[model samples]
Target: MEMQRIMEFPDRIMDKRPRKKPRLTWDMHPPPQPQPPIPPPKVLPTTYHNQEVVNGVAPNHAYPSLFFRGLTRNGSPPWRPDDKDGHYVFAVGDSLTPRYRIIGKMGEGTFGQVLECFDNEKKEAVAIKVVRSINKYREAAMIEIDVLMRLARHDINGARCVQIRNWFDYRNHICIVFEKLGPSLYDFLRKNSYRSFPIDLVREFGRQLLESVAFMHDLCLIHTDLKPENILLVSSEFIKVPDYKFLSRAMKDGSYFKNLPKSSAIKLIDFGSTTFQHQDHSYVVSTRHYRAPEVILGIGWNYPCDLWSVGCILVELCSGEALFQTHENLEHLAMMERVLGPLPPHMIVRADRRADKYFRRGTRLGWPDSSTSRESMRAVWKLHRLPNLIMQHVDHSAGDLIDLLQRLLRYDPAERIKAKEALRHPFFSRDPKRHGYPL
Candidate 1:
């Protein structure tokens, strides 16, 4: 069956440049103000497992708990609790609104804590993200809730994005309930000792991701943060819930499950950094490794930025490591140019005033006359080509995959392939069923 095509924005709309921001500041708006603290919620005893204890605290207790799960002996999980100073004080067996029963801490982020809970009314498990009582976090939580609500209104290519079960204010904290999902792609990769996924698996994940992104872009929403950590696995019959003791052992051994299923669906999560396509977003929105060139250059970005991130993610999935691994902007740009070739002169010229620090006049190269010596700069630029790099890491030689990656990684946002267009690419057109695989 042919996939339904999502309408694309007009060329004029896609080509239109965003309004210029102040040359001095990269932020589009001022940071949120701090608000008076709200009193903590009162916890009531529930009839659940009263003997269960989490972090030395009995059930229905409230105290800051430490939950750390390492990916490998040397690798750490992305979400680590701040034991020295943390605001997440919810405990297992605690009841929220008398409908949801907190089971255990799933994860934690900058703005909130995620808890695995059971929904009494629905008789199913759900993930609840409880924002900190701080006013700034509360506001961000509301924005995320709004985005999730809008996204849940539609299904893309018969696959639904992560659903928002419900949201409400509980004890001065904004709590968002989402459908339960398994570990993130980051966790999956880490569990397998950073081994690259099979080609067919990558194709399945890539297709769904493109559909999800296209669905969001169709509604003018841009997920500024797109990475392995944010892509979660949809729970399946093959998935088995690991007990806390088993998880602790798996963290040390770097093996979560004995054998991973042949296929599993995925969903995009974490909408805190999401915004309208037309909004002027902060230049430092995406993670450093997956950030788009336009974002690094401070050129205003749009929906195409998300596609750029998808390109980075696809490469990481194939290589089991970031395509560009650097915290410094100049070094990051150097890494990108090494693989993708130099940025277009026109793009460099249109960059913000900060562009002067990296690029030289009448040159496509960067890091001009800075602390780094010319010899070192030349050496860095002489890195491996894209094809050679991919061939060395990825086990497959499918030309279609390479073609799609090239289009998605274009330096010029206007020239970069849109998510909807990517869905129609020959890479996804191949029938997985013919290969004896169900996607």
Candidate 2:
């Protein structure tokens, strides 16, 4: 069971994953049977007797797993004090149950906070996501749990996404235990003062990211949000790399330096927004910085939206800054055009009514208009093209990286490269020194 828990993480990343079709869901309950060519289960109304329900998530013939109301079976709050946000109030050495003891706090979000804990029975350190006792958040946690279970069941080798250790209803909060992981890519970059990673490191990170996307796609799921913040380094270890740009200063005072991950192993996380290909995609998805052009234009989207996000993430990893840093839709579109060339005539023509205001008659964008402030226009102008941006930060394999970014960031979703194809791009296969993990 020890070996079964987690071993051979390298094999989990299958480089030759078949180019297959995949989709995912957020409102979606449980995924279909594992593997591609998946056939949908019939939705014949039915019920079960003497059913073993975990947190009211029971096995049903029709929906199979969508029948749960919330994290608790009776929809009743447990006998425990909660914060103003309905988040569980926990502390170090507090007992989550008779079995798990809180060690420290890992992080927090809108849903709830994640606590580092020691599993008494398993005797291992784990991270538990203590969901808010609120009904809506609890329900969302159930969906996420189902999705994680599906991924874990299918990905027997522990590949692509993070692995779940266990889960339960603790004091009415959906306590999900995950194999503890290190800091997120976003956190690492912030701690490093937003210094860019070496090209060799970027290549390894890119490959694993594509493989994870390919795995999710192959399973018919689309992780709507793909950003550095959602990607975690498997280990927290790092080594100091002297800043060559400031080598003289470093030689004298040792002030400027960069921390590079000792290992390139990573895992994808945050599946609360995952949606199936069959589900409606009109509503906006993805973080503002990583949002695809199609999502902004309200022209519907699919797997390619994830590809667009991958392009942004790769750029951020290489340059240590988000590709698009605007909150306004028009400015976001403007940034897209400024960096990746034009927005494509067809994309502008196909823009939904809301997006039309950002465009003029032809392919020209409505910029420098009175509504657009001077600061906004200047920011857009300051951005370099895809090639120039990559070349500015990366010293080697810039050409291959640029070409891959072009395909991944294509304004036309139909023309965007698939995750499987992106994994095979010359960038990954170019140099032996660039492909493998950091030594």
Candidate 3:
């Protein structure tokens, strides 16, 4: 099975600060017409025969061969223990038949806490995300494991996406083993701020991201939480038993550093929030700053939302600032209007009506008010005049970069430029060998 690649990053990257010059000119093309929708399966296949319908699963399952390994048959959870059936407490080793040591806690999210541990036989680092017992959602964690297994074979050289080595269920917790990487993109960004990257370097990063988005879009998958924080970098390759002594010696003297391994690739991190097209019924997901226009109005949006996020990140990289960082939801919409104009009528009609179903109220919704709306317009004008403002820094102006940003950040989802098309833009017209991304 081929591990599909999304983006490649060069090793030994310089951490130099970016120039304060205004953006240079660039190009953006419109998105292609929406593809024809696929017809639904009208007839039930043999796979759907005399089977139990437990936890949203068909009775007779036809397992996928190549990618779908260790798939759970949607087992249902019984009543909670306090009710005398669902309650249970598991110590570190109580779950695993051959349990290992609990090294330390990694994090705690809305779902549950994650712990970092090491497998004895495999001698590898693994992260185990744990969730409380819920009868209705017992199979939910397993679904994530299944998705990760499917995505395991996907690899783009120089990309640092994680792969599942193994998965198992223990008591109330479903433990999934994954390939570990260094600090996440969030940490990297904080340590190295917006000014840390040059325009060219930022463009390269954007290109890689676009390729990843494009690949995911092709598979009809949407990474609801697409942000710098979710990207990972994998550097040193694991050394086996035969090289134990040498590996230890190298570890002592930093042989890994001396050898200067290939540059680690950028990989998308969290998949718990990922959803497949035609399968996923929800429309609401993603962070506020990177959220798409359609999402703000609660419209039934799709993959195009991810593209909007990519564009926002690109602008932040180029200008050392967020494209839209307002105080309130209405102000956010106004800010967007300053650049992309008013919200489309169709988008407003389809806006999400069930606010409690997804996120908190009073949170940003991308709508701009009149007062702030006018200020947003002025900001746009100033941004358009960015070239003149940047005359003191580099030899380029805002004009040099606005065209590219304009096309990528278009408000209209139908008109938004796609990843594949953006790659062919003239901004990357130089050194195809060094920078020509194979997205």
Candidate 4:
């Protein structure tokens, strides 16, 4: 469906020009197939006004526990693997406690499985993320609880965090309740088959995401994994129209909003990589593709690492493809240089010391002149030969997005622009008319 009302603002205070979408043209491609008119997912009533409705029912069977499977892996099946259906199959009727009822399985990960569930009291469909690996589940559950609690307490510009309906800790499992937003950003991009992202939509998504990260930064928390997979849409309606006036005021003054509605806002998930502060801290941790240079090199880093991930997220969102995806350390560095220009002249002491030992196998061992040259870096980036991918999905040339991306992905943590500053760059603040999306 066409976006009903694109956010528009009348303010024209800035003389800056909106960054142009690259002039490059190509073979015209048709829009995606008509997505079957599936009804949007049900929305539960919040403490906010104008609540949306949802539809779904709970299953009558019990959800089988993974405890027995874990035991079997160590030896033989703890119980009979034979059931009436076949070689023992589980159903959803098992998890009917008080507030939650298992409906069906939504997805699974290394530590846990997510179930499409029904919140009995709220009468709303929800996604219940149950940690099956009981031992490893604690860490995930703790992080999820902390992040959700923090978001529930804080207020920010046109941004929304997840709401914890309730949480339960079974003897062998921990189930955290959350309002089930439909699909994740990863799912959306995949459905599109990685092509033709709307420029305005990406900017809008980026702005909201940064605002959320900024809020987390203030709380001294870092979302180590800020990729599309960890970002879930709250509702299609919530993100369509941004509050331009509210966001403008926030940029001008570091103010916060009260009783914010989380309509189209994104709910950050998967804090498995999140690190909390110690009395005195040092070192780094985060995922590979979206990881900041300092973190990758094993140097000390803080919240800014999340901003770096945010930068990568913006590129991916706009292009519907990953920007830096090399698996090898040297190759990854080369890709970074191609997109970000170069590594800084000065390196973090910890990172440098580690690189001296770990990075010795390749030309990266050489300092400055001994290292990979600029031409080689460009060649490595070109080797991917992703021009059509960039043009078709990103709506811009690699160079154009690179210019904007460099500000957020800088090697020097200090040099990396703050979220607020990045939002004001010509990319967003350039045009107050068409580009001035409502907050």
Candidate 3 lDDT by residue in tens digits, 1-439? 1121222222233333221121110011111232232333232111111112222222233433222223222222222232233333334322122333344555554455555555544556556555545643446655665555545444423252565655554444455556555544444333333232345555567667877777777777787778665665564221111222234553443222211113335567667777888785465677667777777666567777788888777666554455666544555565676566655554554556653222223343433333445665565454433233233222332444556666777767788887788777766554534645321
Return the top candidate by lDDT: 2
lDDT of 2 at 434: 52
Q: Tally clashes: model 1.
A: 0
RMSD of each: 15.3, 11.7, 15.6, 14.5
**What range of 10 consecutive residues in model 3 has the weakest lDDT sum?**
22-31
Q: TM-scores for all candidates?
A: 0.73, 0.81, 0.60, 0.65
Residue-level lDDT tens digits of model 4 in 1-439: 1242212222223212221121110111211222222232332211111111122111222323323321111111123232332212236543324345555666766556676666656767776666653455555665666566555556432245655655555334566677666456765544334432456556667778877777777777777778777777766332232323356554542222111213445777766566664423346555567878887676677878888888878877765567776555666665776555556645624465556543433324332235657765554657343344345455333455455677787789888888777767766654435635433
Candidate 2 structure quality by residue, lDDT tens digits, 187-298: 6776566677888888889999999999999989999989887898887667776678767563434435567777789999888788877776647998889999999988
Off by over 4 Å in 3: 1-100, 135-139, 153-160, 193-195, 236-264, 319-321, 326-328, 344-401, 432-439
Residue range with the least summed lDDT across 10 consecutive positions in model 4 = 19-28
- Which predicted model would earn the best TM-score? 2
Better of 1 and 2 by TM-score: 2
Off by over 4 Å in 2: 1-80, 250-253, 434-439
